[model samples]
Target: MFKPFINTLALSTIAIATPLIIPIIAPAHALTEAQVLERLNGIPVFTITDDKGAPLLGSAPQKGSEKPPQVLLFFLNPDDAQATLTQIQKTNPAVGSKARIVIRSMNDAYEVIKKNQDKKDIAFQIVPAKASIESARTILTSQGKPADKLPNVPVFFAIGGKDKEQGLLTLEQNGKQLVPFFFDQKDLQSLIDRAKQQQPDVANATKIQVTSLFQVLDSMVATKDNKPNPDTERFTFVPSRNAFEYVVKNQPATTPAPATKK
Candidate 1:
């Protein structure tokens, strides 16, 4: 079925092995790039480029724009959508990030990510990226991809309206284990404030090895070597404004709540 199996849209995805087995594998690809992009939620900014690559509509924020959308990107390794949610809350705290955040990892899970959405409060809106390398490169550059800095799985990006990577945040934990670390609100706050700092130009984004969230993002994407997992995560639904009341009640004013969550 590999050849002449389906349409010309080449579909490739990364998957995690679960304990359970499926009696029958589904037809078509498990993670379709188009389907993933449809599930995202937020202010919903996009670029409608012409055939020659000119913007028709739906552009991102440009420099010197005060109201530009704040965007954060999480590149997850093990690529579990459920685990993806916890990491976002811990690092970015969905409730107060004034910026829009998107988590991209290995594709191949719809129900898995969706189930988590029903139960927990995913602080920010989620959106999948273009599954393939070429398409993804286009979206990332709709702003600009720091091919020099970010590299591989678990890369985080803090982007402006024009889609430039202002602050890139990366994480090391494999999907869900992020719970214990982020549980402490005070500690988490410190990291959030730290994300605001500007990163220096990566000497060689492609050659860089990832140890921290920021370094990985700055290195990996800059190289443009690794292709993002096809099943990029996107927000299907978002929480209401009432969501942040809990944070306000518990955290001190020093809390770096850049924006409100759900």
Candidate 2:
């Protein structure tokens, strides 16, 4: 019943047609706002919205006030977003019936938060998929680190080297070597599997590292004034496969061609 409406909404606002793993080069100068936004453009997030395209909000109690802060949930997985919408539908059919999934770039959400930095009544939170979080916790525990301290929406990367000296694993695609940072642990595992097949020499040395999206973005911004190294790696962001697949499947349809003249 909601398929037509979903398609309409998708066609109207879906700017991304496929999952993109964009390579970002470290600049010689400090990262500019434009640079950060450009890097963020390649990563997509999902959110549920009404027919009017407004995100649903929830409240949490404030630190020292009777009023609570309104939080806008940005999901890393389309399934998680759908699950949330389903719960809403069960609890309140009126809003659920009109709600639809909205695909948006990470930059879109960043801009929203940036524009509202001065506002005290609202907050924006990126909700990581539960499976991803569990995988992250397991990784942390295996690394002898406390799993409870894992950051929200952790990004994973693989590195390989000998004698405690390690470097990020690079994959060759389109004849160019690129480093990939995955938003989902399962995706990283897939990459690890591929690495073992393609680069057997370094496969055994591979080690997983975890970091948050916020930390990476901040590091990029903070490196604007630093000197650029010629050997600096080009980093690629691999969004969650589930989210990426969802966007690709529902991409806007191509317009029909006009009739040819006789």
Candidate 3:
């Protein structure tokens, strides 16, 4: 089925073992470039605010300027999202403007921002967008796949401009399991350039490798040649705002505070 690709898309692993008793497998159909673009644009988008309740990024790009290509990232935990943002700031400062980095979180943005309020310069926008998150869950469920499950690590969609077409990239856990993923400004620039082109080479996109999330952390980092096994952890659903409150109240304090983004 497309489970391997789906796992790659969600940054969640899946294990497919051939059973002793063979079950009928359906033939999979490749998505046309147009259908892929439509689905990419159909991915829900919404507005978000900072800790002060001021709006940050809106549902769509600003008027008067052509919409920039976007990178939509979904994070299971706020801490992971913040950690990734910190790495970006330290490694490559210009990634924010290179592509519109939109981070989606199930936790409330106000509290998520409050947790890292000491770090003022993080470039990404984290929003507590539950409806949009649920929409993702619905689509996955209807596909006869696992219901209510999403990627654990950062799941990235490189969305093109003009037509809003997209390519998928996921940062699966590195072989050492020390870093979830890494990327730099140059990587974003490449995606942005691809989006700007009139006719993107869609076939080449599907074969793209799922690389390390630590490209920002270490330039020498190497990627695993093989895909990760299916992640066994089950997805948990909670009210976005409520998750933030719980995390804020109970988040461990023993870990030393991280340095702010430069």
Model 1 ranges off by over 4 Å:
1-167, 172-190, 194-262
When summed lDDT is taken over every stretch of 10 residues in candidate 2, the lowest stretch is 1-10
Q: What's the residue-level lDDT of 126 in candidate 1?
A: 25
- TM-score attained by model 3: 0.20
Best prediction by TM-score: 2
- lDDT rank order: 2, 3, 1
RMSD of 3: 19.3
- The TM-score between candidate 2 and the true structure equals 0.79
For model 1, residues 51-99, the per-residue Cα lDDT tens digits are 2322111224657845444322222211323344444446656422332
TM-scores for all predictions? 0.17, 0.79, 0.20
C-alpha-based local distance difference test score of model 3: 0.29
In TM-score terms, candidate 1 sits at: 0.17
Query: Once superposed on the true structure, which residue ranges of model 2 sit more than 4 Å away at CA?
Result: 1-30, 62-65, 173-175, 222-225, 229-233, 253-262
lDDT of 3 by residue, 90-208 (tens): 66566422322233222232233445544423323433233434444554565565754543222222322223344232222232111111112223334434433523454234221
- Which sequence of candidate numbers ranks them by TM-score, best first? 2, 3, 1
- Model 2, residue 156: distance off in Å is 0.3
Clash number by candidate, in order: 41, 4, 8
Cα lDDT tens digits, model 2, 11-102, are 11212122222233334344655665565566767777777677777776667856897767777788888898999899999999998777
